[model samples]
Target: MQSSSELFPVALMSAELRGDLTEDVYRLKPANSPDPSVELVLTRLGRFGQEGGRGVPVILLHGSFSNRRFWYSPRGLGLAPYLARAGFDPWIAEMRGHGLSPRNQQYRRNRVADYARYDLPAIAAFVREQSGQVPHWIGHSLGGTTLAAALGGHYLGEEDVASAALFGSQVSRNYWPLKVPPVEWGGRMLLKRFEVLSGSWLKRGPEDEPIGLALESLRWHGLFGRFGDAERDWWAGLAEVRMPVMAVAAAGDLQDPAWACRKLLEQVPEEHRHFLLLAKDEGFSDDFGHIEMLVSKAAEREVWPLVAHWLEHQRLPLTTAALEAVAL
Candidate 1:
């Protein structure tokens, strides 16, 4: 078993490579009408053994209110190098309103649909242009939802993804709803009204803002609790996906329950779909919750090994008999 400290060196190396990496960050100007541009930043993981590997490229998408940097932490949660060592070139995307990518200068409204329509498509195109491959996407939370939307033909004309994996995401309304405090509801309603009228609202700094707003959005939109129309439609789009998918969730996750995650897997059209649930006692002692599945100390030991194994199985094109045997 590799110690957490052993992982730090690799992470440091990765950071150094990223610091020197030179990739163009572009502002995607929409076609036809002059709509506000969407920010696009692209960077490559340097000189991995799998640079010329035969498997489809892989891209990592972060959840709401997060940027690509979350995946590069010195902790073992960073999946890029691990994927690289397993023979896949990894790419990370920062959606608008997180990290270096923010809303357009002319338009600051934060709509989830914008992620599907612009950010996802732009990143896909950029990956294809740079790598000459239609990549497989792996997303967490809102990132997963956005990818499902894109794959379902809600945004792009024809799906270019060969396969996808969603971690800690679900579409059931009965599961968890946003938990906004009543005291904040009035303030939020007023803010929304202001945004509608003024075309933009105040942008809170990361430290200055309270988690209540984010929590409320999830509650109101049924992201954390019950399923809603948007979530159902999102899951319906999953049925349209022709490629294989892997869905995972944590057992103790209050945000997305384990049963809900398995339910999501049951709806997948692909027979090759696989589901995984990590019990809270598996290896983590910090009471690893929802987001920690991707960013915790136990991730390398518990979470990613499953992902690595699945990817390896996928590369060989296992037969049903072989898959069943492997499962057994």
Candidate 2:
């Protein structure tokens, strides 16, 4: 990996129109990090059919073992197009080694801390520079967790964010034996030996995850572990965040249960926050699981509209103090 001072500048790698939507992909190199070779790709989705109605900039982040396809499939259909048609400029980000972003020199050594501290800020800066506005960020699973970490650690500031929505993301879920020191330490040792975990082999998703991420998670959930790194405690920093935020959880998501998701939302001691649970018990047609909560046909018809509504309302003027005090 090159030194931070030797890192290259961000540039537009390519642009093409898929059907009626224009797709522009940008690459960003970290300005200051241990590994300057790490590059991130942001794919912008816009509706070419509508010329004059460019809406607010909204960035969508995919979870682990996934890429931009999580938001827009190869068929040119999904939430990215859905948002583009709705008037918003949607950018789908592919974290290092995922999708179009090529693997960095230290790819196998990547961690969530590296992502929150380096990649996200680079992505935010590039988006703000290009769009001339703080982008509203929406992330799922590990993606959402990284957003939360950036906010809490002040890696991404209020000036860099318009608002944020986290879908099916949480850090409070406990893995029973992993909480034991020996078990956690042993697990970390075992995971660190591998360069990457294949999603296809694991039957988890469409991409492979660096083993460093798995090691990072093990350290956080281990005995005496907390939702934080050596520098900051993200779990506690949530209360200091004042921006508008939304957390969505699925009832049938055993991977990250609704209770755990709500607990994460509760940590943010603020008024401009909303919690949504996709459960049949909550008047939905079915109990939605982790992936199904966002990618299903039901989500297209039911949930995506709510997401669009939130994005639209987030741009509105601040409400009264009294009204803002009421939790949604």
Candidate 3:
């Protein structure tokens, strides 16, 4: 592994104040990755009062066809800002070809494997260097799935993560037909015809997805396929993850249902792991959908506070001895 400065040359793009929150944006390029064009954009948000304290660093990963905006709006409203207002240093990352990130030279060939092996570790290294501490991670949907891949494959170790919280993410919603050889081949052939999936047209979100991502997912769900990459079995590898984990699901999420999310959570052998289902039965007024579970106004009142509490639990307590040590 290379030093953070060597592996990722960062460009501090801009900094501005959003109401009382300060937002700083940085672009990080993996100088060592085979794909030279790949670059990731990370946005850091902190409150004016919390600057010197440097609150517990938290990174938020957005789902597919979305960007940093998913965690925050132009007006500084959303979970990222919410966390910052509560004295958490929140960082939002945009994956390749999404939001502020530029498309890699092999953008069309980008896959979750690439993200797990190359992009994530670079992000972790950069964050650790900047913060002087391991950061907790939170992801939604495909973002969460990629986080799972990184953890399951051991791309990230316990030292890299304080904890992980995944929202509406899973790999267990199996499609049986894709398991068949002929069906798999046909699907791949059809998908290969397109270079990217139009998120705006598909009504999924604002950003388009590279066709390579679709193909990679098909291969995983295919009959002979498994969750891991070339080196390890990701599903089996989950049991080895030692960090405290949380998996959240929305009852009305037809895309990735609660049961499927639970199945993914169940695979993790960590005793500290937990699952939360956002359903009417769970006291939420409605069975929250995939997006609603995180973005709705309801989330502002209920979900965001839960997330803040969870992050607080994982943070290292600041004892007087520790403060004195810092002074020395």
Candidate 4:
């Protein structure tokens, strides 16, 4: 394989349209990345009828073991499509070894650290190169976690981002089991035996996740461990992020509870920060699960529009503290 240094940053691979929306897929090969075989797939979605003009860019990052389809399906029925129709240019990114992006030479060794440090920056630069504007970012679950890592680590800054929104994303939630040194070491040892976790076997999602991700998580939750690698402390770096930010959590989501999500949001200075808890107690029709919070029919009526509004205004329609208390 040629060193990434020898190749251009991005190459347009294919283009198509879902109904009136145009889909142009590209492969991003970052020069700074350690492995030249790491190819990240990015799809730019054009507006419903405007194929010639580009709108403001919004990049959507899917969760663990997921791909672009998490945001937009083939039938043109998801947030990516909705954002496109709403006069926003949506860019769907598939991380290394997911969706249209093929597994690279170091696929089993891939971790969120690689994503935050290298992959995301390359994707953002490519989008800026094509769109000629800073792009807003939205991420769900692990995707959101990776985005937080990038922001908190200072890999992404105001120069690259118009705004950011995180869905079902948090790191404050503790795994008590991993806090025990023996258990953490044992789990890491067991996970190291596999190259990837089978999503279908686990009945979690469609795509498989690298064992490296699980190992990294174990280290983070191990005794005296924190949410960063040996290089930088991501949790501490979040204080340095000054961009507009929003975090959404589901009351019914046991994976990432609303309080932990709120804690992650609180790490940011309160100036342009927003938070939403999807629960009937909060006036929603039902308590939403982790994935259901964004993909459900109820979300279509209550949540998607709010996200669109946040993208346009860079904040949500938040009630005053007293009003929220009274409503509760």
What TM-score would each prediction reach against the true structure? Answer: 0.69, 0.92, 0.93, 0.94
Clashes of each: 13, 0, 1, 0
48: Cα error in model 1, Å: 6.0
lDDT of 2 by residue, 86-139 (tens): 889898999999999999999988888988988888888777767778899999
Give lDDT for model 3.
Answer: 0.86
Could you arrange the candidates by TM-score from highest to lowest? Answer: 4, 3, 2, 1
Weakest lDDT window of 10 consecutive positions for candidate 1? 3-12
Model 3 over residues 155-267: C-alpha lDDT tens digits?
99988899999999998898999989999999999999999999999999999999998998998899888888778898888888898889999999999999988988888
**Superior candidate under TM-score, 1 versus 4:** 4
- RMSD to truth, every model: 9.5, 4.8, 6.3, 3.5
Error of 4 at 107 (Å): 0.8
How far residue 229's Cα lies from its native spot in candidate 4, in Å, is 1.2
Which candidate achieves the best lDDT against the true structure? 3
